[model samples]
Target: MTASLKRFAATLWQADGRRFPAPLSLLLVGPLVIGLCVAFILPVGRLLAVSVWNPDFTLAEFVHITESPLYLRILGRTFLLGGVVTVLTLVLAYPVAFLMARLSGWRLAVATACVLVPLWTSVLVRSYAWIIILQRNGLLNSILTGLGLTDAPLPLLYNELSVTIAMTHVLLPYMILPIWAALRTIPRDLPLAAQSLGANAVRVFFLVVLPLSLPGVASGVLMVFILSLGFYVTPALVGGPETLMVATLIGQQTTELLNWPFAGALAALLLGITLLLVTVFNRFLGLDKKAAS
Candidate 1:
């Protein structure tokens, strides 16, 4: 190995500063490759192994996951929540991202800071903050009651509504940043040129800007959906029993029931679903092609 590496290094220098041999390039990436194997591959391999193995090899855990209505319902709910959150984030983020892309100077800096500061805050803190605002007789309810919007406080906290609101707030930045990046790559001249050609502002945006920014939208959707699927803390704090997700169920299996095999099965199922969605996104939405461009 030492002699081969030496030969590869010598070949790299002989080619001047223009080109590198395959072996030399691989050597440069060796640390990154090893780190990925150690950090990601091994853990995933172990999780897959645990899903199939319970003392001896077995399929019972997976069978339970498939056969149990409770597990199935939670799994479905997790996907549904992820989809809803992704859509909500996209709707809220697009305008902000568009404005950020168009703005410059101190205005752009301030807008960027507004989006990033919340992301820098801890998720736990944000979730708890939502709890304070959404609870009965809390800030929202107090304001509503003062305005005589209703006779009494609304049931806001500890439900699906609160969960959706909090999760959307937490994940909004993920959607905005990618869309902003995609929008930034687009030249301002294209929109102006479209307008000069007699297209209205709305038509110019739809025909030119929106299509150009789809890559970022696709990226943001995929990221938010995946993150929402595995969310634990926010849902736990803000959501009621009716809004239980797969991740929460997995936690219960692992900690409360001491069912490692069942937990592994749940985790594997979630991982499989995530991979399936990514495949669909890449195939249908052309996310990979868009991102590359």
Candidate 2:
């Protein structure tokens, strides 16, 4: 055994020896990387080309989007809706994430299961559930009426509020998962150290926990915002004219009006915005590190 080991080491040290990486590595990676580039990258390239490059390479599409007050209004509204959904998800997810991180064995698992259970269910089904809960004579409205808050039901569904609620609900798991993971990475000793120095729980959270958790919060916010920007099903289901988002507008233009070029332009712009935000997030918060675990 010792002689065999010495021979093997001597052979490896030979100047003409070849490297030993598996031949299957390239075969495994090449096709997958090429497939992604061909499927996703090429289509996005075409959409961006159609957005700005017409037959004569004129700036007509750009001008139309910028000049039209309606387009600007829709763009602003989409951003506003995305922002609100992102904020709502953050606010709702933080406590859930903290509890999941701070709890022990079975309690943590149960909490995580609850958050993920909704994610496994269909978004359309959840949206429909919200509709039933928020509509006139719906559960929420009936409760409010029974409580003497109002004689008539409130207009809850078919508006921005409904859309925001649904989108936030749909994207909440994205916020919670990242935040919980981030909180888990924090050593338990840090909070104890803060407390040992006479700091209260509130101060420890705001000073130590919150700062350490910002990376996760940033990642989750970006994820929710990007998802909300491209959301069509929820907005289409719940949003009225007052709550029309960019994705629904793009779909209407392409499917109903047959304005393929305009729809392509809108879609390309949305994709660009999503990529830009993600790049910015990676630069600021190191998503790669959190995602690795």
Give the top-scoring candidate (lDDT): 1
Tens-place lDDT per residue, model 2, 233-283, is: 898888867788899998899789988778777887677677887898788
True lDDT of residue 232, candidate 2: 88
Root-mean-square deviation (CA) per prediction: 3.2, 5.0
CA error at residue 66 for candidate 1, angstroms: 1.6
Worst 10 residues of 2 by lDDT: 16-25
Candidate 2: which stretches are off by over 4 Å? Answer: 1-25, 278-293
Instruction: Please identify model 1 stretches exceeding 4 Å from their true place.
Output: 1-24
| All candidates: TM-score | 0.91, 0.86
lDDT score, residue 175, model 1?
100
For model 1, how does the per-residue alpha-carbon lDDT over 7-106 read when each residue is reduced to its tens digit?
7667776456776677778888999999999999998788778889866688888998889898888888889889999999999999999999989999
Clashing pairs in 1: none
